[model samples]
Target: MKFGVVVFPGSNCDQDMHDALQNDLNKEVQMLWHKDKDLSNFTTDDCIVLPGGFSYGDYLRCGAIARFSPMMQSVIEFANKGGKVLGVCNGFQILCESHLLPGVLMMNAHRQFVCKNAFIKSADGTPLKIPVAHGDGRFQADEKLLDELQVNNQIIYTYCDKNGNITPEANPNGAARNIAGIRNKAGNVFGMMPHPERATSSLLGNVDGVEVFKFLGLN
Candidate 1:
């Protein structure tokens, strides 16, 4: 599988994602700058990451402004064509802002940015790495969207404890419905708040996150 990690001005994890995919997972990967409007040059199969970071200094509410980037237009088109896209952290915000996924990220319900290694769950048979860190991580949408997510099995992850059961206190950003990760209606596009790339290898301290790639059959 070929992996393209999108890079925006303030995207700190762009290289980290690239290293994890190329070095750890041994997949073909490259960094696609946000300015590059042509992504058709790199579409082979299954995997492109919007990576985590404060794009554009988080000036207009996380990914609100990033949705208009030159490259995202092409990205939207790519995803619509059935390519898999993974949006982590701010990238998740971008997915929501781009309307590729449902809902919006709000400041943590606590009204503060949060950074911690929290546990989350996958209701399906897909096993995943369990821990990740981030701020601005809460997910919220209306009842209708929530209903739609459930009906379609698009809710891929939820905050939970080591036992794999969700806990109210574990809701780090007070995400509605404990939403931690989501997939597009087609199930090919995925976005989450966790940094799976950072946790993929033991040298980085844990291999739990490798399954995010594996779940997509990349690993």
Candidate 2:
């Protein structure tokens, strides 16, 4: 499937996402501008990606401003129509702000920007070492929403240790239930805090990030 990476003002990781999807995964890719509202070139089978970055300089909250972008309007419609969308880091914040994904990305528990490798595991206990970089990456939701997410199997990934054990020490941002990533109930939209694109290259000494794409059915 084709991949379209949106470029919002101040977006720093758009190229990283493009390279990972095009060069590393050998997929067709297009750089979609935030102002462009057209998405006719793509289909429901294609995936739209919101890469990590400090959109709008992270003003008015991490992704608060970006949700109103022209491109995001089209993205929202696309996702509502069963189109696949993936958001990473700041992009994940946008998804939450747009109501595409549940929960909010709050400030890190330590109140410090975290930029380091973090371990996260899938529901089946499969572990992947991915890099996370953000000050407001902690995920929080009310008890009712948490139970709904659990019942719907919407929680996709949680913080874990190298041995694939979920633990408090492995939680980098103190996300609720150690959640590092999750999907919408429809399973077409995904949001995650880690920068999987950063680990997709062999030069990075880790290719575990590619697994994230695979999970999205992109590879």
Candidate 3:
């Protein structure tokens, strides 16, 4: 399926995601502007990606302002209709703000911006080394919601070490349960802090992110 990468006012990773999908994965991709509300060209078989960046200069909150964009309205409608939506970093924040995903992305435990490579593992113990860059990347949710997520198998990825051990020390931003990524109840929408697109290219010395895309049925 083709992929569409949304570009917001301050988006910096839009091209990165496009390159990963178009060049590395050999998939068709389109750059969608935040002001454009039409998604008629894309179908349920396609995917819409919200790349990492400081949307609207992170004003009001990380993604608070960007959620009301005309394009986001269409995105929300698309997601509700079972369209595949993937949000990374700030994009993840937007999904939460839009209520497309549960929980909120809070500031880091140390209240500082973090940018580095972190290890994360899937439910089956598949590990990947992906990069995370954000200030408010910590994910928090209510106990009830957390339990529901775990029960539904919606918690797709969690922080871990190189050897695939889950520990507090391995948690980068103090996300609750070390949650690095999660999917909606229907599994059509996904939100994650770690940047799998950044790790997809072999030239970067790590292709573990390819496994992530494969798991998402992108390959």
Candidate 4:
């Protein structure tokens, strides 16, 4: 699969995401500047990746303003047509702000940007590299939407301890329903607050995050 990684002015994870998808997953991946409107001029087999970073200096919010980038306008159109989209960390924030996915990435309950090694229990049988990093990653959505998500099997991953119990402390950034990540109703689009690209190497201590990329056809 060919993956497109979007780069905003302040996106720090663009290179990391690009390299991970290219070298780690051994997939054809390209970097698109935020100002680029003609992604069609690049690769065709489509999969979109939104990487982590303090886009626009995290000024208004994690992804609040970055959603307006020219590339995003086409990203929304692509996703509506059943094209797959994966948003990690700040990318997840952009999805929420654009309503491409439900919920919001609010401030951590402690009102601070959180950065640390973190583990998220997978609900699916597939294996993956666990996620790490983030400060304003608490996930929030309406109760009705939450119920719908569960009923549809859209709640792909949840934050939990080694035992897999959803607890307040286990839920980093205090994401609502301990939702570490989720998929759209179509299951084509996925957004998570954790950085899967960062977890692809055992030398990094864990390879739990690689499954997400594999799931999207990278591996």
lDDT string for model 1 (1-219, tens) is 788888988898888888888888888887888989877656637577899999999896999888999989988988898888889998999999999998888888778767667777688643344555566778888899899998898898888766676778878888988888999888878889977877888886877788766765566
The lDDT of each candidate is 0.82, 0.95, 0.94, 0.80
Select the stronger candidate by TM-score from 3 and 4: 3
lDDT assessment of candidate 2: 0.95
Off by more than 4 A, model 3:
none
Model 3 vs. true fold: TM? 0.98
Expressed as tens digits, the lDDT of each residue in 64-174 for candidate 3 is 999999999999999999999999999999999999999999999989999999999989976789999999999999999999999999998999999999999999999
Per-residue lDDT tens digits for candidate 4, residues 49-157, read 8889888888887788899989999888888887778899999999988889998888888887777656675566443336657888888888999999899888878
**What shift in Å separates residue 79 of candidate 2 from its native position after superposition?**
0.2
**Model 2: worst 10 consecutive residues (lDDT sum):** 210-219
lDDT of residue 157 for candidate 2 = 92
Ranking by lDDT: 2, 3, 1, 4
